[model samples]
Target: MADLSKDYMSNSADPKNIQDLTTFVQNLMQQMQDKFQQMSDQIITRIDDMGNRIDDLEKNIADLMTQAGVDEHV
Candidate 1:
């Protein structure tokens, strides 16, 4: 196994090496951000689905109670 950390970090100040490291970090951050956005979108969609189901259930219960002629006092 090669130790990437050891090879990337050097005492010498090489411009090319610094640029390569910076590019690599930038790419990694972009990938992470994209995945986070995807996860957030999925969560929001699921929540919306749940809310729709709850709304349907509420409507069904109200309809049933009205059909049965149940009063709030009773």
Candidate 2:
């Protein structure tokens, strides 16, 4: 519909147009940064969760080996 590329590439020499474009770009950047931060946080949380699960599994295996009288060296 609207020519977004033209609007973005238009000259920003006019005071009003410059202010508006600056505000728009700043808002867009902030929103993208926020989304990226959220995704990063989620990934970190999932990684931590997986680490905990792996640790639990390791401990459980150790316990099972001890109960079964398996040699630690083996």
Candidate 3:
């Protein structure tokens, strides 16, 4: 395998640099979380629309069966 430990050893200096790095990571994580929430909201809205359409279809089917003299209770 390639020497990965050497890369981590290179940045083992200066506490201020590490603090700045932590702040950058936290900001990135927050932005990612906001984007994820937006995507989830859109998915939920689409699911609700699909559910409404399915309900409409079910009602139409029942109406058609009734018009054809088919007993839905059977």
Q: If scored against the real structure, what TM-score would every candidate get? A: 0.76, 0.79, 0.71
Order of models, best TM-score first: 2, 1, 3
Question: 1 or 3: which has the higher lDDT?
Answer: 3
List, residue by residue over 1-74, the lDDT tens digit for candidate 1. 25666665552357877788899999999999999999999999999999999999988988888899986456
Q: Which stretches of candidate 3 lie over 4 Å from their true place?
A: 1-15
In the range 1-74, model 3's lDDT, one tens digit per residue, is 24566655656555777889899999999999999999999999999999999999999999999999999999
Per-residue lDDT value at 67 in model 3: 98
For TM-score, candidate 1 versus 3, the one ahead is 1
Q: What is the per-residue lDDT of model 2 for residues 1-74, given as tens digits with 9 covering 90 to 100?
A: 36876666665566889899899999999999999999999999999999999999999999999999997788
Candidate-wise lDDT, in order: 0.86, 0.90, 0.91
Error of 3 at 25 (Å): 0.6
Weakest 10 consecutive residues, lDDT, candidate 2? 5-14
lDDT of 2: 0.90
TM-score leader: 2
Instruction: State how far residue 1 of model 2 sits from its true place (Å).
Output: 22
